[model samples]
Target chain A: MISKASQSFQVASPSVADQARLRLAPVIRIALLLAASVIMLAPIAFAVATSLRLPAESFSLPPRWLPLPPDWSNYKMVFQQVPLKSYIGNSAFVTLSIVIGQLITSALSGYAFGRLQFPGRNVLFWLVLATLMIPLQATIIPVFVLISKLHLADTLASLILPALSTAFGTFLMRQYFMQIPNEFEDAALLDGANQWQIFFNIYLPLAKTGLAVLAILTFNAYWNEFLRPLIFLKSIDKFTLPLGLVNLQGYMGTGSISVVLAGVVISLLPVLAVYLVGQRYLIEGIMMGGLKG
Target chain B: MSVQAREHPASARRPRLFAKLTEPSLAGMARRKAAMGYLFILPTVLGIVIFTAGPVLASFGLSFFEWNVIDSPKWVGLQNYDHFVHDSRALNSFVTTGKFVLLAVTLQIFLSLLLAIGVQATRSKILRYFFRAAFFLPLLTSAASIAIVLAYMFHQDFGVINYYLGKIGIAHIPWLNSSGWALITIVLTYVWQQIGFTFIIFLGGLAGIPADVQDAADLDGATGWRRMWDITIPMLSPTLLFAAVIGVIGALQVFAEPFVMTNGGPGDATRTVVMVMYESAFSFLQIGYGSAIAVVLFVAILVVTAIQFRLSRSWVFYQ
Candidate 1:
């Protein structure tokens, strides 16, 4: 077969320089990748190392690469200096609320836009897409005033209320719903299942991966959200982890460097945990943002 | 117009008389489906109208009026815009933002592309996975926390970075202390945290390049840099554009890094447009000016994004 012949036919042998380059390329690539990984992981490793060292040993002439017999006192000091627990709790509540809210709103709208045919559907989807261009920083002024008017200023509700719905989440879920086979819907309809029944029982169950992607992405985003909390929440008691971490760093002049690093470590743990568990979903979802329209 | 409602095979197989009997109920069912569709979208529509679209319009309106939360808004059409023109600090902030966006986005894209190519070239799966995960690790941490950690590490005296450099016989670099290096440090810190997203995107794009095209390039004696530049780069242009667009948009709104690390200090070195907006609206209590700045930023983003698309036509390959 022509195809087999073509597959078997190798490119003409190269000169010595070309052969040398070919043999050296992968080694060079691996070295570069290894070097890049070291650069990426170095900061966090240093942070962890610094957090375990004493204040006196923190900035020694030659930095300690490893903190032997690691001190847990710096982490304890982080707790004493800041309300790390309250910050974690507040962040968890707000992030979970937003995640649940977005799932409901995005899923329902996504199902409708993806499956159900109606007048103005394309126009409505375009409207949603347009909002993606409007940066939150551009709109926060009015949002601030709106929150103030609602007498929700300085409350966690201000943080939670506006973020409960996301244009991006809707788009993501709509794409996900569109990928599901239409045959399932048709089959369910023939089985006499109403629209709500079909959605809840069949399609919703099948959309677990999509929902997980949305939830994880949303959690990572809002948990790390600083601008909204910085602008809205005035009280320290109402502070989220990011705001709290920044506040802790403000005490860098008085407190030990180890304590501040400890605080940083504490704030990142939950996100690290989520990432370790759901990395496949997170990476795929992020890739989807670029690869898909 | 609606999609044609799919007919059941049983209905299609039925006699014309029976089909006629079912046609009225099928119309009723279609109407109910439409109603359900509207109902499903109601919450999302209401939320968007209230939160996103309404705020956009309101911010535009507020740009024409001065309000400082405690007092009534006084209409002053064109006043904020005029002030913005004369405000050197605001203009300077935009310039700083431009510089940051240029340096950070370019490095972010270039580095991530190299990393993606490296990861893709690896023969060992475990090494590939390790590299991918390691690069993306920092993205899991908040910008605030990362900035906190980096601020300490980049300290001029008694910091780890300077300590290491000193060992290499290099003098201590004033990373965050001086205005010259502040923006660069911010760029480095930001790229460290944000490059993961773009790296993953480029990896996805790299995976999509066809094997036959690569083999053809190889047969043409295009190996190493030549192959990457002539074949790989052209094929990956669409993803590069996406990464560049997203990167620019994000870098333009650089806030948390500068806000936490430098507080836009050392004489407005790292002060970004969004930082200016935040200060005017919150710290300085100049709501109208902040809104005006916000409007300018919004327009800047729209224009920049539009320009990227327009320019991309010459370079971006569809396939």
Candidate 2:
């Protein structure tokens, strides 16, 4: 069916035939990727959908793909039925404090490791990295003891204070700082700037990307943190979102699928918002942070 | 130097300033550097020592004594160890954790590698970005939310999964309720959440691979499975080993998903060692017993990591 010139072209560079044969490849690959993505995202979508559906609409025989009349009441009910606002406030307070504290501590430590020359620098850096391998379960019991002994148990401070320093955060900032040129620091030093001024003015400006990444990561970790809150926070008033959601399960008891889904939706909003706003930085930061540490 | 300085006023001024800066004393500069270094590092050092290192050492010491929060510590050297060795519940948990690790890590690594290959084989940026976001979305979702949603999704009746099964004329399966299937459900959830991470790691490794090596393989008449086995796999070995080790460590400490989803349920079928330790410490108020289990888990992780490092030298090709 081909013309002579075209046939010669195909024969000369059989890659043409190969490309023709591989024309179906992209379609197939796209389909597979789409299918996998759906599988990955299905639960999240279902949570969102179920949250928007009424109690009767949620358990239909042929499950409703879309709610007939979108029920905004579930959102109202979540706030009314649970102490959702207090939990949100508590989570926000703990997460913000921890993020700020961790950033300051990590930046200081990272700059020390990256730029400063001092005795035992290598040894100290190695020690910090060593903590990354120690699983949290290994220290949970003692942490609980320490918290209780200090009478910080049943308070938000227990949640915030213990997480003020992380090995991964230090490692992330150090890697970021190392990428910056020394000329800027030298110039600052020659201009009679002290070390703190150099760090704040020179290093921090260059480390905006690192700080954004750390903020997103720290927020995510702190938001969903359950064990620490569960162990430390005894009162219902002090509970964070995760504990609130779990306690919501107890109130619903059984077959209150709509209410539970509503709670899940409430918990997910902040994280999803953070992700949508900081998507690019989140991905890049994860790639850099995860690979190094 | 003097002749050059004479030719440029700027050079002469710079030397004079440098001389003034350096003339204070060498010892003074040393003292300043030491003070600055400590000032910079003080917060982190104090935080680690008080928060991290203190708890770790306390845990080690607490493992030797029996104490509830309300009671005085009674010295029980190796009694908790003896109890751990003979306890059927502890043994079951150990086995369950091991099984979860083996199944979860194996499937996670395999699926992620396949995803990486699929992503690499494609040239369309749109499709690749879609898959990247899709896989990475679960990583963003909180484990607590995932557990709640998945628990509903796997509901025995009126669940989407069962609806599909009924449409296909198959019987409903109790995913979280049956002892046999409960652990598998948790394992699948673990894989679902973790595939994004493994896929990302693989993608990072894939980007590091040179395009010419793949092109040369194609020129040498390698195609499909041959190309993958001979060229791709060998080149990606370092990433594979890294993923494997991380997967192992993560799997061994698996807690949140199972904790939220099944609560180590259907009659202890999914009781992980961490869950056991958690119960021992908090529920039973047996600090000494929990500490012993924690110590055992630590040693196990160390051994596994050491073995992985040893084994990696032979097969992991770093370029």
Q: Which whole-number lDDT from 0 to 100 does residue A278 have in model 2?
A: 87
Q: What is the TM-score of chain B in candidate 1?
A: 0.92
- Where in model 2 is the C-alpha error above 4 Å? A1-21, A288-293, B1-27
Report lDDT (Cα) of residue A148, candidate 1. Answer: 91
- Each candidate structure's TM-score, on Cα atoms with residue i matched to residue i, is 0.93, 0.91
Q: Residue by residue across A185-210, what tens digits does model 2's lDDT show? A: 77986786766678789998898888
DockQ of each: 0.41, 0.34
Model 1, A21-67: lDDT tens per residue? 55665666676677778889988998899889887677765778689
The Cα error of candidate 2 at residue A155, in Å, is 0.6
Q: Can you give the lDDT of residue B242 in candidate 1?
A: 90
TM-score of chain A of 2: 0.89
TM-score of chain A of each: 0.91, 0.89
**Model 1: residues with Cα > 4 Å off, grouped in runs:** A1-13, A290-293, B1-24
